[model samples]
Target: MTVTVRDLRPEVPADVERFARSRHLAIPYVLWTPEAIVHRTTRTHPDAHYRSLVAEEDGETIGTAQVGIAHDSGEPGQGYLNIYVQPDRTRRGAGDLLVRAAEEHLTALGATKLFSWVLDEPGNRAFAERHGYRASRSAHFLRLDLANGALPPLQDLPPGVELRRAADFADDPRPMFELDAETTSDEPSDVGADLTDYEAWIEESWKHPLLDLDLTSVAVVDGRPVAFSAAYTDRATRYSTAMTGTARAHRGRGLAKLAKNDSLHRARAAGYKEAFTGNDADNEPMLAINRWFGYEICATEVRHVRELG
Candidate 1:
C-alpha cells in the first residue's frame, strides 16, 4: 500500500468530498462539509499561504492536512498544520506522509514555529511527541442535545438592549466585523490572531458557506453589536456555535450568555438536533455558560508546538 501526499484539487468534487469525509471521521465533534472545505482552501488570505493536502492510498484519500501560515498573528513565522487520518486508515503511513508534506511546505515558506492540534488519546499524543511537538494547551469539544435538552428560557432584555439575528446586518456587516475582531483578539490560542482586515474577514468568515446568518444571534446596544453568538449549520440537523463572546465593555453583564441562549433556543425550535462547540480549558467563564445550556464535554484536543531551525 503506497501512501502519497498531494495538494487538494478544489475543482474536483470527489477530492473535496473525500477530504471532508476524512476530516469528519478523524474529528467528528466539529462540523465538516465539502463546501466548507473548498472555501477554506480557496478563500483564505494569500499571506497565509494556505494549502490543503491529502494522503491517498490507491487513489482513496485516507488523511488530510490544513497547512498555513498564521497571517493574522502579530508574530511572523508562525505556521499551523492540522492533520487528521480516517479512523480506519491509521497505521497505513498516510498520516506520516501528510505531516511530512505539510511540514516541508511550511518550512520552505520560512515558518520558524509550527502548531498542531492533536487528539488527547495516547496514540495521538505519542504521534505528536514523536514528531518533536510539545503539548502546550488543551481545549474541549462540547455537545448539547438541542432537540431533546431543555434550554434556558430567554430573559428580558436589559433597558436599551435588543437581540437581533446576524442576517439583520446583511446590508452592512462592518459592525459584525468590528465585534468579531474585538472578541477574536481575546481568544485563547497558541497563535494570537489580529483580525484587522475587514475585507478579508468578510470573504473568509461572513461569506463562509457554513455561516447560518439567520441563526446567529447578536446582542445590540445603542444600535451597535456588543455581544454575539455566531452559528454554523449543515442545513440539516447538526448545528455548531462557531464563536460566542461579549465585548470587553459588556463583560459580567451576562450578555454573552443571553445571546448564546437565544441562539440555542432558536436552533432547537428550528429543528436542529445536535449542537457542538469548543472552548479553551482555561476559559472557565464560557465553559460555565455552556454548562448552563446543558452542554457536556465530548472530546479534547491538545495544542502542540514544534520549533523549526
Candidate 2:
C-alpha cells in the first residue's frame, strides 16, 4: 500500500470531509469540521502561510496536518505542524510522509523553529522524538457532560456588571475584539500571539463557522466587555469553549468563571450534550474554574519543539 501526502483540495467536498473525519477519529476531544478546516486554510492571515495537507492511501485519506508560520507571534521563524492519523490507519508511512511534507513547507518559508503537539501516549511521544522534537509544556483536554453534569447555578449579576450574549456586539464588535486581544495575549503557549489586527480577528475568529454567538457569554461593565467565554458548537450535540478569559484589570473577581458558567448554561439549554475545552497545564486558575464546573481531564498532549537548520 503506497501512502502519499499532498495538499488538501479545498474545492473538493469529499476531500475536505475526509480530512475532517480523519482528525475527528484521531482526536475526538477537539472540534473539527469541513467548514472549519476550509476557513482555517483560506481565512488565516497571508503572513501565516497556512496549508492543510492530507495523507492518502490508495484512494482514502487517512491522515491530516495543519502547517503554518506563527505570523501573529512577536517572535519570528516560529512555525507549527499538527498531524493526526486515523486510529485504524496507523503504522503506515502516512505519518512520516506528512511530517516530511509539513516540515519542508515550513522550512522553505524560513522557519527556524518548529512546534507540534503530540499525544501524551508513549508511541506518539516516541514518534515526535524520532523526528528530533523534544517534549516541552503539556495541556489537557477537559470534557463535561453538559446534559448530565450539574452546572453551577447562574448567580445574580454583580452590581455594576451585566451579562450579555456575544451577539449583542453584532452592530459593533470592537469591544469584543479588544477583550479578546487582551486575554489572548496573556494566554500561556509555546508561541505568543499579538492580536493587533482587528479585521483579521473578525474574519479568523468572530466570523468563524463554529463560533456560536448566541451561546457565548460576556460580562459587561459600564457597557464595556470585561470578561467572556467564547462558545463553539458543531451545530449538533457537541459544544466547546473556544476561549474563556477575564481582562487584566478584572482578573481577581471571578468574572471569567461567571461568564463561562453562563455560557455553559446557555449551551445546555440549547441542547448541546457534551462540552469540551483545553487548557495549558500550568494555567491553574482556569483549571480550577473548569473543575468547579465538573469538567474532567480526558486526555493530555505535550508540546514538542525542534530547531531547524
Candidate 3:
C-alpha cells in the first residue's frame, strides 16, 4: 500500500497507456492518447526540459505529472507542472509524492516560478492553496454535439477575404505562423506568450500529431492570413478546436465566426462525432462566438501560480 514516484517509461506501451488512462480519469475533457504522450515527450523543444513522472502504488500508476519549462515565453525561469491523481486513489500520498518529484525536477532546471492548473473544485483548490499556490484566471471546457447538433452556416467573406485550408500552405506555413503569432499575442490570458520562433512553431504546432490540416480553416485577405481556426482531431471521431482567433486589425468583422463555422461544417462532414474546446472566462468575444455555435460548458479549471525563490 506504499506509493512511489518514478520517471514514466516512454518506451513502455503499458506505462504510457496507464498514464493516459489516469489523465483521462482525472481530466476527461482533453484528449490524451498513447501516441500523443510519446509525441510530446520526443518532439517538444529541447529547451523545455520536459519530463513526465508517475506515482505508482502496488505496481499501478495512480497519478501523473507533466513538468516542463515554458521555453516559448521570452521570460526565463517559467516552469509548469500539472499533477493529477486518480480520484479513487487519492489520500494515499500519491499526489504529495508526485509534487515533490515534479518540484525537484523543475527547480533543478533553474525554474524560478511555477504554474499549475487546478480543477475548479473545493478540494482541488484547497490542495493547491495549501501548497502555496494562488488562484488566477479561470477557463471553461466546452463541448458540442458535432454529429447531431446544428452548426452555424458558413458565410461569404467580404470583398478582400477568402477561405482556405491549412494544407493549402503545406509548402510554406510561415503565413499561418504569422497569423497565429499575431492573434495569440492579443489573446486574453494571465501570461502573454509570443510565438516568435517560426521554425519552432512549425515543428510543434503545424506538425502536431492531432492537427488535421485539411479540417483547419483560415481567413485570407489580399493573399495573407488574417484569421484562422485550427482544428485537431483523433481518427476516432473526436474533434477539437485548438485555437480560433483573428488579427487585431481584423477584429469586429465577424471573421472569427466565419472561419469557425467553416471549420465546424468541414469537421462534421468528415465524420467527427464529438467536438471539444476551451476558453478563458474573460474572453467574452470568443465565449459569445462559441455560444453562438451551441457550445456548452462541460468543465472549468482555475489557473494557480506559485513563486519559487
The superposed Cα distance between candidate 1 and the true structure at residue 101, in angstroms, equals 0.4
Q: List the residue pairs that clash in candidate 2.
A: none
lDDT of 3 by residue, 1-309 (tens): 889999889899999999999999999888888988888887788988998999999999999999999887768888898999998988899888888888898899999888999999998899999888999999999999999998887777788899999999999999899889988887776566888888878878898988999989989988888888999888788999999988888888988788889999989998999899999999887898899999999989999998986
> Residue by residue across 164-191, what tens digits does model 2's lDDT show?
9999999999999999999999999989
Winner by TM-score between candidate 3 and candidate 1: 1
lDDT (Cα atoms) of all candidates against the true structure: 0.94, 0.94, 0.89
Which TM-score value belongs to model 3?
Answer: 0.96
Model 2 is weakest, by summed lDDT over 10 consecutive residues, at: 249-258
lDDT, candidate 2, at 131? 96
TM-score computed on alpha carbons, candidate 1: 0.99
Candidate 3 or 2, higher lDDT: 2
